[model samples]
Every structure is written in C-alpha cells, then in structure tokens.
Target: DVKRGKWEAPELLKEAKSFINKHKDSNTKIGKLRYMAVEDKASGTGLIQSISKQTTLPIRAIQRSTDKLSRTMDVILYVEERRVWLPANAPWLLNYIEEIEGLTADWTHDHDDQWDPTIDAINDSLAKKPTVFD
Candidate 1:
C-alpha cells in the first residue's frame, strides 16, 4: 500500500532512541502504570476522548512508536506484483509471513469472480458515467 506521508528516517531513529532511554528503567512508578488499562475505564473515557480530539500528538506519537519498534524496516505492500515483501534484516518479518500469506489467499478467493468483465455491462456502465476514474 502507498503510504500517505513521507518517512523521516533520522527523526524516527532519534525518537526511537529517546523512547528506549526513557523506558529503559522499568522500575519507575510511571513506567509501571498501565496507561492503556487506565484509559479503557469509564473515568478515563472522557479524558481519552478529549485528548484524542484536542491534539494530533497521539497519532504522531503512535507513528513514532511504531517506527521505533520496527527499527530499520519499512512496511510495504506492492500492489502491481500482488506481493508483500519485508526486509530480511527485519526479524519480525518471519513472525508475520504466515499471516500475510493467509491474508493474500483469503483476498484472492473473495475477489476472484470480480476479475471477469462483460462487454455489454461494461459499455452500459460506461455510458452512464462521464468518467470512471473521477
């Protein structure tokens, strides 16, 4: 899949390093607190909702966190080749290959019938629309 935003490798690396440094000490009270569990409760609902609405920080922070976790890898889905390729350097790829293969198989089974086109139906549909891509 085409990523909508640009990838900044340096910034991502810096953010990853910072995250590691900040979280390296697991004994801290703040680190021990499960933010996700807390955020799921009724009391935290309003706080979570308000935070989500008020700032772009959450999405940016998540993207940064994902970038950090992945380290050197880039996530890519090649549409033309109908293949999902992951770098050999990325060890996590091994863990997900089976899942990715299953997804491709499922997608092909679901969409197989849609590939055949009828000329009469195509022409009729074309006549109704000024431009198909639009």
Candidate 2:
C-alpha cells in the first residue's frame, strides 16, 4: 500500500509495477482497446510514462474538471438503481462495500482514492452506452 507521505518516482514506479504484475491476467484481458486512466498531473505524468514503458497496459491521462463529490455523485443514480455490480465473492468485497457506504458528500473520509476510478469508469461507460465487462 502507498503510504501517506513523500514518495520518490522510483518508489511509485515499483509499486505500480507490482500492482500491474499482480493483475497481469486482467490487464491482458483489458487489452489495448481499453485504457488504464490516470490523472494528468504531478506524479501521474511520470506514472503514465513509466507504466507505458514497463508494461503492456494502455494508459490514458485524464484531466479532472469536477470536484470529487460531483464526480462521484454522477454515478450515484447507477449505484442506487443497482446497475453497479461487484465481484460475487472477492476477498475485498466487504471492504469495498464499506468504502462505498462510508462516502459522504461533505468529503469527510479516506476512501475517495479507491472509489474515484470506479466512478470514472462507470461514468465513462454510461456516457458512451451501457455495457458490461467481465
């Protein structure tokens, strides 16, 4: 896990590599058509470059315009309507659900990082057209 302190580029790169390797099969399945989006600022720039050079995973740099709450709220309807689905018996299932439940509009929590990409993916899907991924 990434600690809440200063991080060097090398450290971040190593962590990214570990994460990518850990999910190698899924990454391969995701393929070149789908991108792994990263914020287009600060360390994210380096991360995109590093991941692109070191792994086969495609990377898309995203420039976030809206605040966290607004971004998350955009997908709230999907969640409420039970359109969002989680893995049936994943090990982290309970923790993931707890994080979703813990989210507040007031930005009073620490799970935003974990949930941001999920919301982004859902919004991106809904924006284009409703689709399911295995």
Candidate 3:
C-alpha cells in the first residue's frame, strides 16, 4: 500500500452529530401514572399525599413516580388567584380530566398569587351565617 489505506479522511476525521430534540416514541408507565395522580384534581403541592391516598401506595413509591413524571412535565399543577391550573393540551384530554376524573384546571397553585385557604373558610362562615333560602 502507498499510504496504508485502512481508513479514509472523511470517515476518520469527521465527527458524528447527535440530535436529541426528538422525544421518545411514547409516554412511559411512570409518566402516565404521574398524569393520573393529578387527574383527580388533587392539589399541586399535595400531589404526593393525594396520590398516596388515591393509589394506596407508599410515599416513597409515589415519590419515585412523581420524579419520573416531573422529568416529562415540569409544571404538573399549580394554584393562583384562588383558582387551580391543569395540564391539558388536547380537547379530549381536557374533557377526560373533567368528565372522567371530575377534575378542573387548577394549575395556578405555584403562581405568585398563591391560593389562600382562609378565603374559603370566610366563605364557609358567610354561607352558614343565614341564607335567605334557609
């Protein structure tokens, strides 16, 4: 051989490129479980507790599931302005969460204007004071 022709310049010198923009083919089991955790209109902060109660799973196990889901969706749920925010990209998903899960969009739990439980207490007191219907 004139120059030891074992490799070519293009093959040996070129560096391979990686494209990571594309996500996985489908959602993982843990991801789906995490979505369902919030599907019951559970509180954003109390997601772990709610999921634990609903699924009867230990906190550690639920935490593992939550970890998996957080990787996919950062803002799982939120509350703000005395309202909750929900995760819904498709009409079907929104309806499913509403009708099947009996949950509404309550994603504002982590907003600057946090929901105040005291307001609900005040409303409750007012409600019990004396209603014209009563």
Candidate 4:
C-alpha cells in the first residue's frame, strides 16, 4: 500500500505548495503552515503553545526560527496537514515545511482544526480589505 500510494504523497505536496503560492499574503496559509510545523511533534505536539510549555524556547524564538527558515528554504512543512509547499522561488523552504508536516503527522491522526486566535485576527483584518489577495 505504501508503494501504491507513494504518488499520492508527492501529489498532495505539489497541491499544497501551489495553494500556498497562489495566495500571496494569505493569512490562513501562513498561520496554518507555521502552526502545523511548530505544533506537530512526537514527544510534544509541535504547536507553539506546546513548545512554549515544554521547552525554554520562547514563542518568539520559535516564530523567528520558522520565519528565518521559510525565508532561506525552498519548502515549508505543514506537518499537521500532512503536506509540504514549495515557496515558489526558494526550494529550500519546501523541505522545511515538509519536515514540520511529517513530524506533526507522526504524532497523531486527528487533523481536527483547533481554534486559532491569530486566524481570527487575520480574518478580521482581511475582512477590511477589498479582497483577501488584494
């Protein structure tokens, strides 16, 4: 089954990357991917809050690490969503997102959407715009 479904993984990753690249300044894409990477972990959920609780790494440090990696890498891993996105130009970021997603998926199967305060703020800000992309 793993071999037969092998193509599915790449396809999913391609789709996820396309989705992320298509929407410039998409808060959902940014938040979801970052959240998944940081929150989805084995010993601890890779979530920002979880990371903050379990380690001395400050939330800002986690955020900065993710941001710096995204800026320098080709792919960004959204582990919670079990997908990876290619950052249009930066191929390095693609693997980063994939790593995060892999770590997140390994920890659990329940991909339920959790309440995100950041998403709410982003949504509110987006609502004021003529369009989310614009």
Top model number, lDDT: 2
Residue pair clashes in candidate 1? none
Rate residue 25 of model 4 by lDDT: 40
User: How much lDDT does candidate 3 score?
Assistant: 0.28
lDDT against the true structure, each candidate? 0.32, 0.72, 0.28, 0.34
Worst 10-residue stretch by lDDT in candidate 3?
A: 14-23
User: Between prediction 1 and prediction 3, which has the larger TM-score?
Assistant: 1
TM for candidate 4 is 0.20
lDDT of 1 by residue, 14-132 (tens): 44344444444463743431222112334334444544454333422111223211321222212224342345655545544443334342244322211111111232233235667
Quickly count the clashes in candidate 3: 14
Alpha-carbon TM-score of each model against the true structure:
0.24, 0.75, 0.16, 0.20
lDDT of 1: 0.32
Residues 46-69 of candidate 4: C-alpha lDDT, one tens digit per residue: 233433454332333112224323
The digit string of per-residue lDDT tens for model 2 on 16-78 reads 677656665564533423456777789989888888987777778888898887877777888
The candidate that wins on TM-score is 2
lDDT of 2 at 133: 53
Cα deviation in Å at residue 54, candidate 2?
2.5
Off by over 4 Å in 1: 1-77, 80-85, 104-134
